[model samples]
Each structure stands twice: as structure tokens, then as C-alpha cells.
Target: MASKVIHAIYTDDDILLQAVKQVRAGRYHIAEIYTPFPVHGLDKAMGLEPTRLAITSFLYGLVGLAVAIVMMNYMMIEDWPQDIGGKPSFSFLSNLPAFVPIIFELTVFFAAHLMVITFYMRSKLWPFKEAENPDVRTTDDHFLMEIDVEDHDVNQLSKFLYDTGALEINLIDNK
Candidate 1:
């Protein structure tokens, strides 16, 4: 089945944000938005759900912390008991203060790297992937809002978008 969509382009982010809110209030379903840069509160304006990446980051950090603790304990306490500064304490619990920095660093490192990987995977972004934006100009300076016009009147939608400050509007049949 073929579908038709409207691409509304805006020159500024502020206008785009307001247009999104107005369109949603008018019961129009927005397909997606493309912007040159991140617009603050744009997701909220578009009524998008909150991301779950932070929770996953915390879990990754915990795993990293556990790995760091176990690796440190095995290497420092069980494998080779180092008598540093003539203080020979072959116990992980007793010498935990000395491993605090390593634990913290590893936790942060794992969380940061894993979060980036997760984001890339979730967004389906990878090497050799083709660009999906309909307009290349959106990548430089324009903000675009795509609207599905499956059952809606294209003329009415175009008028509504134009009234909402869309700089340009184009109706395309996505077959």
C-alpha cells in the first residue's frame, strides 16, 4: 500500500517547536522531526516518551564496578600480596580504600562506552549506513516536520502547516 506524507520545513527551531505543539493540539499525527542540531525540550513538545538509556547506563556502571572489585581483589590480594610501605594486608576489605580510584574510573569508563554503544544500536546508526533524512538541507540549517496524510486532507494539512509558520510545505506520495 502506498502512503502520502507532508514535509513541513521551518527555518528556526522555535517556530518548529510551536508548530509541533499546535499540530498535535489539532489532532494531527506527526511522523518525525529532523533538525540541524538538538533543540531543547523538543522531545517534550513532540510528546515523545522518556529515554531508558540512563537506567541501562547505571546497570552497566554497576557491572563495571563489580568487575573492577573482583579483578582487583584477585590480583592484589589472592594472587600477589604486595607489602607496600611495610604494611602487609592481604585482605580486599582491609585495603579497599586503595582500590577506590580504580573502581570509580572503571565504573565511569564502562558506563560511558556502553551507553554510546547502546544509543548507536537503538538509533540503528552504524558505519556504511545510508542517511534517512528526506532533505539534505535539514542537516545544515533547516528543521523539518513530517506528517502522515493517510486519511487526512492534504490541502487542509498544508494550510494548517503554513498557518503554523512552516516556511515550505511539500506533499509527497511515499510508495
Candidate 2:
């Protein structure tokens, strides 16, 4: 297979939208899009599915809550029951408010730590891993659209990008 460079046209939001619309209407293949920040409705425009990270965080928080409850109960009531400040440790149901702080801390701790781990894992980002950045400027103030042209007309694609008011155009070599 012959390796070819994919040219990306960078522009503002309006131009990006126009280019995306035209590409969609023409049924052109879009490789990827890079934006400085999350654009509203861009995911819908790109037909992306919702992220499941929030759900995963909730589940992990629940697990933390369970762990907090089990550990506290086992320590305070079952293994070594202790009476502090005249509060009875006979029942976990009683003085539940007292354990609220531990529960809350654990919930936040587990959710935050686990969610970060999950996000890194899912995104394939790991410690000491080299970051794959498309463009340094794109991280600050640029919108990039990458289109794959498989047996497609390069002139037509270039024209479309130019007509849409692309500020810059560059080709990416994909091996």
C-alpha cells in the first residue's frame, strides 16, 4: 500500500462547521478533528457516542461507600467493639451520622482516584508515555479537520477546504 499524507485544513469555528457540513453532504471520509476545547454539539456533528466515564465514577463511588461501611462496621462493631463518647458500637444503624465523614471521604477518594485511572486506561494514556499531539497550536487556538482520501480526488478536497476559509493546510503522513 502506498503511504500518502493527509492534509488538514485549520480554521475558525464557522469555517470548520461549513467544511464539516460540506464533507458530510458529500459523504467524504473524515479521519479526525482536533479542537482547543470541547465544542458544543461537535460530538453530535461528528456522530460520537456519549462517554461512560460518569457512570463508571458513580459505580466506583458506590463501591467505595460499600468498602467504608464494611470496614467501619467490622472494626467498630464486630472485631473490636468500642464505646466512644458514650456512643454505642453495638449497631451500625445507630449513630450513622457519625460515620458520614468517613463515608464521604472514601466516596470522593475512591471515585476520584479510580475515575482518573479508568480515564487514563480507556484513553490509553499512561504515566511516562509519550503524548501523541497533533499540533501544538491546536492545543491553544485552532480547529483541525483530518480527512482520509482513499482513491478520492485531491483537487476537489483541497478546493473544498480552501472555499471553506481554511487559515492553514498541512498534510499528515500516515504510514
Residues 98-131 of candidate 2 have per-residue lDDT tens digits of: 9999989999999999999999899889889986
Prediction RMSDs, each to the true structure: 1.5, 2.2
Clashing pairs in 1: none
What TM-score fits each model? Answer: 0.94, 0.88
Best by TM-score: 1
- In candidate 1, what are the lDDT values of residues 1-175, reduced to their tens digit? 2388899999999899999999999999898999999999999998999999999999999999999999998898888888987655668888888889999999999999999999999999998998899999999999999998878888988999999999999988886
The model with the greatest lDDT is 1
Clashing pairs in 2: none
Alpha-carbon RMSD, candidate 2:
2.2
Instruction: Indicate the residue-level lDDT of 66 in model 2.
Output: 96
